[model samples]
Target: MNTHPAPATRETGGAIAPHLRRLLEFVEPDRDDVCLDVARGRGPMPAALGPQVRHLTAVDAMPAHAPGGHGASGTNGRMSTVEFGTGPVRIADGDTPPAAATREERRPHPLGPDRTLVKADASALPYRDNAFSLVTARFSLYNLGDPEHVLRELLRVCRPGGRVVIADLVRGNLTGPDRDRIERLRDPDHPGTPSIARLTEMITSAGGSIRRLDVFTVERPVEPWLAGSCDDATADRVRRALIDEVDGGPRTGAKPRIIGGELWFTQSWAHVAAEPIP
Candidate 1:
């Protein structure tokens, strides 16, 4: 039997994470609204959301594919339980996988009793149509193989006049044949990053009307970021490429440069909110 390596768990820290706060601003959920967060890896957005919405549901793709599950072919089966841990919502340095928060840990939360968690595929969400007042996916598009399908599903579950918000890293400065190859080497499951223009096209094509779009640039250190998934050799190569960018030797569009004597890269993130045509 052949076995594949485990998918890289995206590091959920850095100043970029707080952009959800700005994205969620578009939703402006009321105390009565129902919210669904799709592809909510590691729970940063959900954590920020739990306190504001009257009810919340968070879902993620299980680490392993489900047998006869919601694949693109339209097969269906019961979803298996996989625990996606929760943590405090804040942007800071370092990767920390908070131990799965207990019910006791969650009780003090405002919407704790009303929150539900599910591990399933994004392409086929389990909820019914017009079920939620707001739907959001953060930092998830690049990892998903079919972002358009996921967007359509997001629109399907949203109530009439409800909003769908997405926050994702836009490919910046990094260009060339080698960019995708280097990223794949670091995290094999990384499909590839998308440009902002492509993302806008996907959202609009999925039958959503754009309400707001915000883009922000963030600077993050490279070594600590790469170390989360890459082996020594792979990390070495990535570091070399980034260093090359610093001296204008090559352009990976990772926007690498030396900051305070430490190597860092820049990424532009987009937060867009759209509504399905009523």
Candidate 2:
């Protein structure tokens, strides 16, 4: 198994919120239902899904190191900023930082008295068979060395006729230049996201049926993508490559077309709902 930590995009919360909303729209958990958020980094979905479910479980592998230390601190990892919109604009400012921090602070048990956080692996969930009524994972599927094994485990723990929801970025979703930029920066252990067709097959083979699949488009301003991090070199490369893409279309091949707007990149997400066989 790959022990390396995966790189989480700065836009995780923002990019994932809409997809969570959509998943909630379809699953609509009852107050008595048991829900689990697999690979629950900083616990976003659990916060949203907790109120509606009888019990919420947030699980992930124990971090080997803390945000600023060498020892694993459970969920406290490095912070990355995500900016939205065009030139010289900050979607979230100083006040926003506190709010974001507050949100994360509440992450440990955002669902309150009824929720639990577990340090565990996705491929071999510690829960018993048919233990939960609903299971959800976001932007986390690609990190697994065996996504199929993990999906099967999720299905195993879910109750008969219960639901499993997965949200992830598609490999070809980004434009050429942006894709290249990501590929270069991406860690070797970072498994490029799987295609939609492959994901669908994995779910069905595990004795689950697909209910709904949707793609959400998110556009981030170039400046934020470049300047959000502390690393100057990465920021510079991103900035220069983006400029090159703007100047020369496919001719440059260094940048992909900015979809939605001139300075924005696209993230394609697939939300799949599967039901366990009764």
TM-scores of the candidates in the order shown: 0.73, 0.68
Instruction: Output the number of the TM-score-best candidate.
Output: 1
Model 1 ranges with Cα > 4 A deviation: 1-18, 62-92, 95-111, 172-181
User: TM-score for model 1?
Assistant: 0.73
Which whole-number lDDT from 0 to 100 does residue 65 have in model 2? 32
Candidate 1 lDDT, 23-110, residue by residue in tens: 5554466577689986534646666776678889887643224443411011222112212212212223533211121112333322
Candidate 2 error regions (>4 Å): 1-19, 62-109, 171-188, 222-230, 249-262
Global lDDT of each model?
0.62, 0.57
Q: Which pairs clash (backbone N, Cα, C closer than 3 Å) in model 1?
A: 173-253, 174-252, 174-253
lDDT of 2 by residue, 1-278 (tens): 22121222233123333334555655556677788888635645776777777888887532223231100112323112212222211122221111122234434555478888776767777889999878888766655437787788888898875778787765442333335335344222335555667778888997787766655444344444444333677656655665676776333223334534445544455667777766
